[model samples]
Target: MKIIGIITSPRKEGNTAWIVNKILEGAKERGAETQVWYFGDLDIQPCRGCWGCHKGDRGCVIKDDMQKLNDAIDHANAIVFGSPIYMMQMSAQAKIFIDRMFARFSPRYSPYFKAENAAQKKLILAFNQGNPDSGLFQSYIDYTKHMFELLEFEVKEVPVVTGMRNGPAHEREDLRTLLKDIGSSLVGE
Candidate 1:
């Protein structure tokens, strides 16, 4: 299985990155091909809402590194989206990446609204927050998961690492072990 880990955190060595990498490590150990992409290292532009993608099969007009991400998603059996909560929501990088995903969906908003890659690829949503309480953003987390489901992804898990202001995820052995297990579970083992 091919799994792609997308890190939307600006800090390559931040808590979110650490969590994503740890999970990817478990997948790698299970012999699953894995690749990690950092948003900070890509030149992905925000969607302009031009409806150009819907006009035909041209896809997003303002092409950039997002096309690479789209191609990766099309080929991946699973995807891990990792982001750090900013202002009680996903980071700007994550938001922009999600917005660019508009090209993957049908333009119709009726019952026919369907994503092009509606193959039910497994998805794992990972988030890190400074707040000590994990439930502080449960509602938003659920919303985000639902959004991915609407995009036709079979969301498998939503792991939130709280109290990150105290320390990075790399220092939390408990979380590391838990996340690694979660990742291993993705390969159905």
Candidate 2:
């Protein structure tokens, strides 16, 4: 199995990246091929509300780095999306990446609206927040999961690391073990 970890945090060594890398490590230990992508290192731009992607097999116009991400997603059996909560919501980088995923779906009204990538891909949504209470952003987390479900991904887990203002994820052994287990579980072990 091939799993891809997408970290949208600007800090490469931040809590979000630590969580994502730990999960990838567990997946690797389970004999699954894993790759990690840092959004801060990519030049992905925000999606323009253009119908270009649905027009005749043509994908998103004005593409920069999202094309590579699209191809990676198409080939991945599972994906782990990690982001640092900003203003009680996903970071701007994560939001942009999610927006670019629109190209993967054709409009329902169009005749070409078929499940192009019908295979249900497993997904893990990981988030780190400064708030001590994990339940503080439960509603937004649920909404994010539902949105990805609508995109045809099987929402496997939503792990939120709260009270991150105190320390990074790597410093918390409990959180590290929990995320690693979640990653291993992704490979059906």
Relative to the true structure, how large is the alpha-carbon lDDT of every model? 0.88, 0.86
lDDT of 2 by residue, 15-53 (tens): 999999998888888999999899989999888887788
**Best by TM-score, which number?**
1
Estimate, for each residue in 18-40, the C-alpha lDDT of model 1 and write its tens digit.
Answer: 99988988888898899999998
Cα-based TM-score, every candidate: 0.95, 0.94
For every model shown, the clashing-pair count is: 0, 0
**Pairs with backbone N, CA or C atoms under 3 Å apart (clashes), candidate 1:** none
Model 2 TM: 0.94
> Which consecutive 10 residues in model 1 have the weakest lDDT in total?
107-116
